[model samples]
Target: MKKVFCIGELLIDFVAEKQGSDLSKATYFTKKAGGAPANVACAIAKLGGRSVFIGSVGDDPFGTFLLDVLRENRVDVSLAQRTETFTTLAFVSLAENGERDFVFSRGADKELQYNSAIKSEFAGNLIHLGAATALLGGKLEEAYGHYFFDGLTKKSFISFDPNYRADLWKNKQQNFAKKCMTFVEKADLCKFSLEEAQLLSGKEDVAEACRFLHEVGTNIIAVTLGASGTLISTREFQETVPSIKVKAVDTTGAGDAFIGCLLQQIAALTNTDSLAGDRDLLVSMVAKANKAGAITTTNYGAIESLPDQEQLSA
Candidate 1:
């Protein structure tokens, strides 16, 4: 199977132990290795798929911990960088139902410098742009654009997930959506949360939103609807696959798990011709991905909650 390349931030998430929306009132925080891309890479690795993570962390102990977590999970970290700046930190506040609010302290993640040396690695593989901070600007943004075109030129399957976070954007939300659309236009596969789909397409209906994105050029679009399930759309197929029932504790890594599983399955396929035309196969893959995601919610933390092949089969 071709390895999935995940590019973006690798940081520490300080999650509140108590379930509530208030971060200020929470007296305790549990640190975990977290970042959308890093979580996806770890998810793929845990499921017995090869994955490589490309991002930056600080030269601090927190960065060391994050790298160790990735390595332990079997994700390749050869391309990961260490910066002099402090590692990025996100404070997560969770509601009783697993809803989360985040406050970010931008750090080394934003300092990721562009390196053209890795461009050849994009050839004939899958590269997932899962960054929440990559689009926010700086050298990471430059790297994102450079690698995206390189992947395209090399006939790579380009996947993108904007992984939109409101707190991170603040007043720059419009810029986020606009910049994300550029990626949406070029991506072979794109994943979006319900809110992100609506905001980007300016459509109330999920189908219409997906249609707008399709018109903009993404060959396949998967819009995640928190509890309902995931809506998947391509030129020849569209369907809403229902989610598995589970008692969700933390939803932080659920979406990552779903996409990771889906991408892994896609990467494992020897016959790429069926990917666009096989509706039943696609639905089945999404169903399996749903189960993977559902299973993730039964546990706490991102990487820790991710299921292995045996766990997924069970």
Candidate 2:
């Protein structure tokens, strides 16, 4: 399999136990290694893929713990950097149905500097850009833009996920959508949540949303529809791949798991350029990715919930 370079934030998520979507009321909390790209890296590594995590964390214990978790899951963290800034953190409060409310403490995650050497090494590999904190504006965002353009020039298979967090954007949803379009317009594969698809594409219908996104430039689009499964689309065809039934404990990282598994399968392909025309293969990959997502919902913490190849097969 080709190497998958997952570039983004790596943070500590403080999840409040049984808290009903109100961070103000949450008392008890547990820390877990989390971040959209970090979770994707772990998901790919856990499934026996060559996964590398590239991002910055604080030179603190929290950062140490996060790196340790990635190493334990077999995710290559050699490119992960440490900075003097404090590690980023998100305080999450879960509702009864597993939905969550989040409050963020931005920190070292925004400090990832662009490396020319790293950009040069991305040639002919797979690159996943799925950071929630990336667009918040800083060195990370600059690095993200540099890596994306460099990947394009190097013939890397680029996948993008606009990991939207309403809490972080506040009243700037329009601005967020605009920033995301830049990536959506160039990515080989784009993954979006139902909400992200609607917000970014300005279409309520899933098919219409896919059309809008494809017209912008993405060759492949996957819109994750919670329990309804994922809507996989290409210019020629679009279909909803079914997900396995499971009582969701927490929805966090489910989408990451889905896209991670999908990318892992894509990385193993000899020619990703033909992926858009191969409907049967696309459907097969999405079906397996759905299983990975469903399995993630059966447990709590993001990285901890990811299933291995043996578990995926069973």
Candidate 3:
């Protein structure tokens, strides 16, 4: 199987135990290793797939803890970097329905510098760009663009997720959408939430949104629809794959798990390029990914909630 190189932020999530959206009122908290791309990396490794995490963290205890968690999950962290800046932190509050509100304190995660030596590793591998802070404009953004183009030049199987966080973008939604299109237009596979699909494509209808994304050049598109399951689309057909029913305790990393599972399935294929034409195979893959996502919601935290091969099979 080809290695999946997941690029993005690795941070600490201080989650409030209270069931309320207001972060201010929340007193007690629990620290968890969290980040969209990092979660995806752990998801792949825990499922017995070859996964590598490529990003930066602070040269501090929180960063050390995050790296330790990834290592314990069997994700390769040799490519991960550490800086003198403080580790990034996110304060989260969850509602009763598993929905969450977030506030971020940006830090060393944005300081991931590009390395020319790593460019050769992209060949015949899988590259996943799913960071919420990737496009926020810094060294990480530059490194992201470099890696993306290098992946394309090396014929890597590239996957992208906008990983849109409303709290981070605030009034910059238009800018965020514009920046995301650059990756969406060239990614081999693209994952999006229902809201992301609509916002990026400027189409409220799911089918139309998929069509728009296809026109822009993504060969395969998956739009996550929560309990309704995921809508998988290729140039030839579009279908909604069903997910197993589970009482969601937290929806934070569900999407990451879904994409991670899908990517791992793709990585194991003998011919990754042929995925777009095989409708039955695509449906089956998405179905498994749906289960991964649903299972994640049954627990708390991102990496800790990811299902392994045993859990996925059961």
* TM agreement with the true structure for every prediction: 0.98, 0.99, 0.99
How far off is model 1, as Cα RMSD? 1.0
> Which regions of candidate 3 fall more than 4 Å away from where they truly are?
none
TM-score of 2: 0.99
Across 230-252, the per-residue lDDT of candidate 1 in tens digits comes to 99898887899999788888888
Against the true structure, candidate 3 reaches a TM-score of 0.99
Ranked by lDDT, the better of candidates 1 and 3 is 3
* Per-residue accuracy of model 3 over 1-314 as CA lDDT, tens digit each: 99999999999999985468888888888999999999999999988899999999999999999999999999999999999999999999987778898999999999999988998999989999985999999999999999999999999999999999999999999999999999999999999999999999999999999999999989999999999999999999999998999999889899999999999999898888788999999999999999999999998898899999999999
Weakest ten-residue segment in model 3 by summed lDDT: 16-25
With candidate 2 superimposed using the best TM-score fit, by how many Å does residue 2's alpha carbon deviate from the native?
0.2
Sequence-dependent TM-score of model 1: 0.98
lDDT of 2 by residue, 106-188 (tens): 99999998988987788889999985889999899999999999999999999999999998899999999999999999899
Query: Candidate 2, which segments miss by more than 4 Å at Cα?
Result: none
The lDDT of each candidate is 0.89, 0.93, 0.94
